[model samples]
Target: MPKLTLDDLAKIREKTKRLTTIRVGGEYRAKVCVHMGTCGIAAGARTIMNALMKELEEREIHDVLLTNSGCAGLCSREPMATVEVAGQAPVKYVDLTEKKIKEIFEKHVLGGKIVQEYALGIGSEKTDY
Candidate 1:
């Protein structure tokens, strides 16, 4: 294989640094998974996700991974969000709105407290062998 030049190396370094900013690595402190299934979309999942992104940006939080997922077989509970912190059980929230999202960010994400009112249940983890 051809060796990478200094310019290429510099570009790689820059990309890595940028990834650490808005990107989540294996050492991420937490993850926010937004359900974007068809039902979720009809129920305003996009808006909820935008609200979440705004909150993360406004708070300048970088240790959290924000991702999207399919349905959780709870179509009635569309526009849901799941928060999974390192070393802690993931909590799924239902009927999410912008206001509720901010509340979740403040109470659950930042303060490490779970909001039972909006919370649905614990999210199951995926394991790869």
Candidate 2:
């Protein structure tokens, strides 16, 4: 493997810290999981995921853990995501577009408010933290 420099190591550390940081003492303030199943990919989940990463980086927001899961089981809502916030009900947004992802990031992720119009519904499970 190529030798890593101090700067490179620091950058890696920062990213790891961001991903592992807990939102509410021990839970993520918000978790953004993109469904990468075949159907989801066909629907543009990759675009949504890229948009989300850019948005978060530009905003210097790192508390949110950006992850990908196989499928959300909502094929009709192919490019969908489940935003789980600490102490609040998780909301699943459907039919995502680039514009919609930004709205969800600004309103739901940053502002701590769910975008009901784009959301299918709040999830039943709650976080233990």
Candidate 3:
């Protein structure tokens, strides 16, 4: 195995930092969270995630954070995702497929309009605090 040179290490560190920033909700314009729990995977969450990734790459879209979380307590709506654009409330989209996810990305993430047809709800649960 070839040892990494100093330059290679620096590059790796930079890449890692960039990704960490995105995951930690850095100055991103939008955020997509795909539910990847067991039920979600069974219902094709992986495919949904891949489709979103492909869209981001094809459009060369930066400033959008992609992430995953566990089941959203709606097992029936297995393949679910949440799209949150900065300054707007988060929208939970349910029963998603690759096609639906792609459309959601274009309309909601990029176009800044909620795709109401596929959206389960808007905004997170209210906290007592």
Highest TM-score among the candidates is held by which one?
Answer: 1
> Where does candidate 2 stray beyond 4 Å?
1-27, 124-129
Per-prediction count of colliding residue pairs? 0, 2, 0
For model 3, give the 10-residue run with minimal summed lDDT. 120-129
Task: Assess each prediction's global lDDT (C-alpha) against the native.
Answer: 0.85, 0.84, 0.87
Q: Model 1, 1-129: lDDT tens per residue?
A: 659988999999976775676544446778889999899999999999999889877877767789888887788988898998788999999999989988998888877899999999886546343
Q: What C-alpha RMSD separates each model from the true structure? A: 5.8, 6.1, 5.2
Ranking by TM-score: 1, 3, 2
Instruction: Evaluate residue 22 in candidate 3 and report its C-alpha lDDT on the 0 to 100 scale.
Output: 56
| Cα TM-score of candidate 2 | 0.75
Model 1: worst 10 consecutive residues (lDDT sum): 18-27
TM-score of 1: 0.79
Model 1 CA lDDT for position 50: 95
- TM-score against truth, every candidate: 0.79, 0.75, 0.78
Weakest ten-residue segment in model 2 by summed lDDT = 19-28
Tens digit of lDDT per residue, candidate 2, span 1-129?
669988999999877777666543444568898889999999999999999999987887766878878877778987998887767877888999999999998898888988989999888333344
Query: Model 3 compared with the native: what TM-score?
Result: 0.78
